[model samples]
Target: MFLPPLNPQLGLRRQLKTIVFRIPTRESPQKPAPPMHDPASTWNTLKDILPGTDNTVATRVSENEKRVLNVFGAPHFALLPRPEPHRSPSPYEYFCTVNESASHVEQPRLSVTKLLTDAWCELQTFYDVFAGLPSARSARLSSGTRHHENLEKQAHPRVDARRVEKQIESAAQKHAPEAVEVLFGTPMAAQLASQWSEHVTMRLVEMADTCELREIHVHGFLDLARGSLVTDAAHVRAAVLVNGVVDLVRVDASNHTQREPWLEEGLLLVDLSCAIPRAKATMTALSKDHFVHVYDVKTRQNDTIPAQRSVLDAARRQCMFYSRFLADLARDSNYAYQSWLENGRRRRVEPDAPLGTGNATELLLRHFETLALDYLRLARGTDLGFDDFDNSHTHRQKQNVDGPEHASRYTLSDFVSAAQFREMLAALYGQDSPFLELDVTPLFSAWKRPLTLRYFAARAGQTCNILEAVVPGSVGVEYHNMHTRRLLKRMHFALDGATLTAAVQHAASFWNGTRLPTATDDMKRCVYCLYKNRCPVKNRATEKVGERIYRLCESQDGACENLHGA
Candidate 1:
């Protein structure tokens, strides 16, 4: 059950039309002049250069390959395998806060995807996050993925110079034009070519001015005439994970509004440890002072520029949510950064060392909020394993009581960290205070530190205009996104205080047996939505098996009718 918007539509019956009332007048096809196979015309040259159907597969490279090496960093071999966090299925219907004291209550898990989708339509998000339901992929979405994956293959440096010509031949055989929408779809493929032209034109202009002749690794699009590659998807791989999980952690920090510390203000995390190649070996420029490098090597795939712009705008809020998560983790636990030195030894870093990417080869404990005092204990917790424990808290308690291993590989720094973490958690969780105060120096270091998380959401920044570039990576120019930011500032990642009061209210109403209204906005998202069959807002729906078709009507007890895009 879901609640309707405060202001309902004036006439719902008038709007729910199965058939498109207005149709475009059809025009007869006219005979056109034959395409002049002239040298001056670009189309003629494109026909000659664009390879015919053959091998479409570009030579795919591994993560450790020479080209992507700089962007993704070196191969990470783990010291000890880490297990994933356990997750419980979330319910869409929000209930009264369960009294865990009387009986155990599970906290709802919220993600950036959930928050963003919830903003779109509460019911859809409820189905996604709460119901744990999976939706079938739409045709457009599948095509978009294919298109983006194609660009990724082309971005590899191996596809450069003489190799590119051979790759073109491969593409000709495998990537046929009419066979799939990804290869030569209008607007998407056309828009990609158009944007690629802009990048090549500007780069050529700059090259002419500087009289530069040195070879540089260019990206997705290539120049058939100059035998040069034009970079396209460099801006796309800012830093985000393919799956839903973003590196998440809790941090302690002062509230921007009240100027005081807060709990439940958790930070969302992104670990870009391998972004810069040489930086990791040197361990200096990589992670310097306040900033720690995070990498997400994902590509963009938006059809339009304005749509891409909108995605970049929405990402700021997501980044803010992540920053807040880090701040909360710092506040609640005794967290310190320890790095492995070049001399085959790990040492205690200052209050802010893990914040740096230097010597961070291990991606699992790459950088985490220490929930306890001593890191040695943290190591022991991992040694025992996660299978026995039901939850994070229970896992921590059992790790201590089970007796630490004597023949363990725990280091000196780990011992100190484990002790401090234990002490910190004891005092903080013991007494009930409006807000917990963390260690003086660490908290102070975090206070002055400007918290920020870098996002490379593939869908959003597919067409983000270039601001700065370092060959494989590009930065997007920031402009004020006031309207979107204002809306985002009101929401919190976790339910704390009044930040998520509105969200909880909606959930509570639904769980209380309130009938949730359909948020389907007419034809906007209804046509392609997987939930359309069950959705009330949809006036009509069609189901097909291969060539056969069956139309589903909204009116009760109505007979089936044959229709196409009605």
Candidate 2:
């Protein structure tokens, strides 16, 4: 028989994982000999013994110092764990605190991303608003930010320094020249001068690459100061805030073969959004025709998916979100849709955006064709970011290599008996050749979570396959509701205004500390959550040690209180 090792220092303070030990004999003492030395001190001594062999501790200390300085130096920087989990303070306390803090100032506007994040994990949304926790500066985030910054810096073409110096001299004769002496005398001044030159060059580049002929000023946001093809400032900020930098917005893209009948009418496309290494959306919106093409440019190897439908459907939802954002802007009172007339200046056209109205369904349906093709060709079965792409040369076709099929394999032993979970599919859908032959259902669920086969119906509500290219009038995939384990009655797209508004309103309620963040049944998300320490949710299992009982965040605790407002 094995027994847990006991240490006087810890006194069972730390959790142990069924450590095995030999039972003491009658003559021996019950307590195991105390550890020879403190684990931490021993590790440090080892490190000292092997100098430079490992600098992890030193490196961590230096990184911490840098991080502290960076946090203190930056304005509006309040660092917190990723997917900030909900914490203490009763609902009354939270609401009272929010009012106490921001009472004088107007509440901040709710962002689309924030809302979507909440939809993904209600608990995360709660922490985002009520907690006032600063977003963590993750490495992925820093890398993406640097990449975008590099691109933006490249916006202004470089010019010969000597040429600029000569121009500066020429300007001195007519106008007061900027301080030239400081450029050479001070490093800060030189850096400033260099920055100013880059700014001036950016304007020159923008001027060189103008795009305002058809829908004058609609070509690009080259010079926002001079005025953009967009109607106003609010819309500009909205795009940047929600989607970051607009990658490329141009009017009338050539390549007629790729263009549809509506292409002849000429189109203004909001081609690409910000380039986050994780998820980069290529949304092409034709405002006038009310047609949009939202492309999912996933590189694979980025996301972790639970169900194939979960992520595939999420992409469509993201696209619709962009469509809605643009539609709202198009319909804004100040927003004047512009058109080129026989006259010199482009005339302001009337708003005819059909994103959420009666014809909204058709327009959204048209966009679905491209999404379906992408699902088949690009994303394969699942849209998990972490899913591996097919390497043409190295990997074999019908290969036994690991992929989403394995990633989505979850253990449902917690919910059902192992025999039932693993054998249920074989009994129910066994006779169905493809479903059974393809191993469509869980044969045996793992102990971690339930494994269930999922199928998603397209907008048309029919069975769909990856091999087919979705056409406007073609039939769709048969509807399947993974949760209900039955057929679905309605479509997710072009949801009426009230439904959409309600969702946003629900998310926005968190600001008032009215809606508490909720824990999802999605165990994988919880496993990856960085804020589990303070999270209210606990796993189903609990361990009682001494006076205190320890519990993990993964428990199926229904009482996972939304500490902000619950």
Candidate 3:
């Protein structure tokens, strides 16, 4: 080695072979022969023998062990395939319970309010029905309710004035000698008389030109197809019962101006001057001479005028639905007129009755009868003081002569005679009714009438129309704060049949079990939702985090490698 460092590698290899030759072989007595060297076995043996020398080899071995343990033992990671997620039933299915006794399922009824709520947040509405969540009460809601009550009271004055007039007339006829003295002698009676006169005069004026009806209840089925699709009749009959109360219906005089003062006044006494001027002014056709405009009133907590676009859109759609239903009721040719009333009555009596079982015309007649009775009672001042009356003046005088204790009280039938009540009914609901007819107008003209939505602040004296303030120059936009001298903001919306039809079809899809309830995209709406806490879609952050984790796990398993690479 000192002579020449020649072949240093050969010298080392020779020394290693000499040491191996010294070791025992298979034929030796002390030990078995060494196993034949296999390249794979030799490499694995080296990896185990020199554990700290090669980190890559140790890691690969450790991973293989883990994979084997995961398959056989109680490992930390999941190795089995994931299961499919559980799905919930749709609203229609959830609400439509199966009747064990019968072969059919009970159909679910939908309301315009519910449909509108679904439009705003289908998830929230679903929770409301499914979970039976109590509606949240707030100061704003209370204020709105009070505002509606006030409007109703304002409308009642005309009825009250008629009642006072009837009392005055009765007093004049029964106690002719002391009629004037009795009326003017008492301060209360005199004040009531004066108020009555003023109200009657104002009512007469209002009747001649326009009338405002508040809280008109309306109901009908949602026509999902609108004759657009060729579907089965049974599919079409899937239409659900939709009902709602219209906040206001404004009836304006049409070009046909034939005034029947007697009909307009609705007075017990008919005079020569009250005669109908035109032969066309029959009981059934009066609605044709009017242009009907629908309105919806909304109250907000702040002075913000127009409200968010979502809010305005909802309000517009709600008003349009109300208008459409009302127009349908007013049309003689519409099937709803013949079926709505009976259906309502049947529903009232048998809440779980099958759909499309009752008649609407009969139900309407009942409503008219009730309305007539109410008007007659109010006009006769039964609510005020005229509680007792008779057909003959002598009988009335005899009752008056008797002490108050001995006087016989008149029944509702006696208070307002059947003939008189029927007359009023015919006047209010016959062809001569004050409501406008959609059938008489040009196509879509009735629906096209400008819809006004008025908003009032929770607190008084703060209001503005946000739409008018934001975009003053928009076309077909009329902004006004005329109500209560700027305390209200009114936005006018033009009815769009296409948009309304689309919305109806969309909403109907959910009710018909064709679609799932959709969560609102607007975060602000979620903030106000009563079901936000438990809503599946309210907190997107958690969902997003979970989705990311899922994707990462999938990529690690090589299931989503392409997705990660992309």
lDDT minimum window of 10 residues, candidate 2:
458-467
Please, what are the lDDT tens digits per residue for candidate 1 over residues 1-566? Answer: 34444434563333333565766699856555444323233333233333331222322232222221222232222111111212121232221122222111232222333334333454454433222343437675565445434433343212122332232234334434444332222322222222222222222222212222111111121122222222222321221111122221111112211111112224222111111111222222211221211111122233122334324433433333333322222121111000001000101111111221111101112122212111222333322121211143255355653234222232322112334433333343333422233321232122211110100011012111111121111112222122221111111222233432333334333333343423635345444544433433442211111122122233324332322212
Q: Name model 1 segments beyond 4 Å from true.
A: 1-108, 129-131, 134-303, 306-317, 330-400, 404-518, 540-566
Query: Predictions ranked by lDDT, top down?
Result: 3, 2, 1
TM-score of each: 0.26, 0.31, 0.45
lDDT of every predicted structure (CA atoms): 0.26, 0.29, 0.39
The prediction achieving the highest lDDT against the true structure is 3
Per-residue lDDT of 369-430 in model 2, one digit per residue for the tens? 11222222222333312112213212423463334543343322222343432243343324
| lDDT of residue 294 for candidate 3 | 70
Runs in model 2 with CA error above 4 Å? 1-110, 128-131, 146-290, 294-316, 332-499, 539-566
RMSD of 3: 21.7
Better of 1 and 3 by TM-score: 3
lDDT of 3: 0.39
Total backbone clashes of candidate 3, pairs 3 or more residues apart or in separate chains: 18
Top-TM-score candidate index: 3
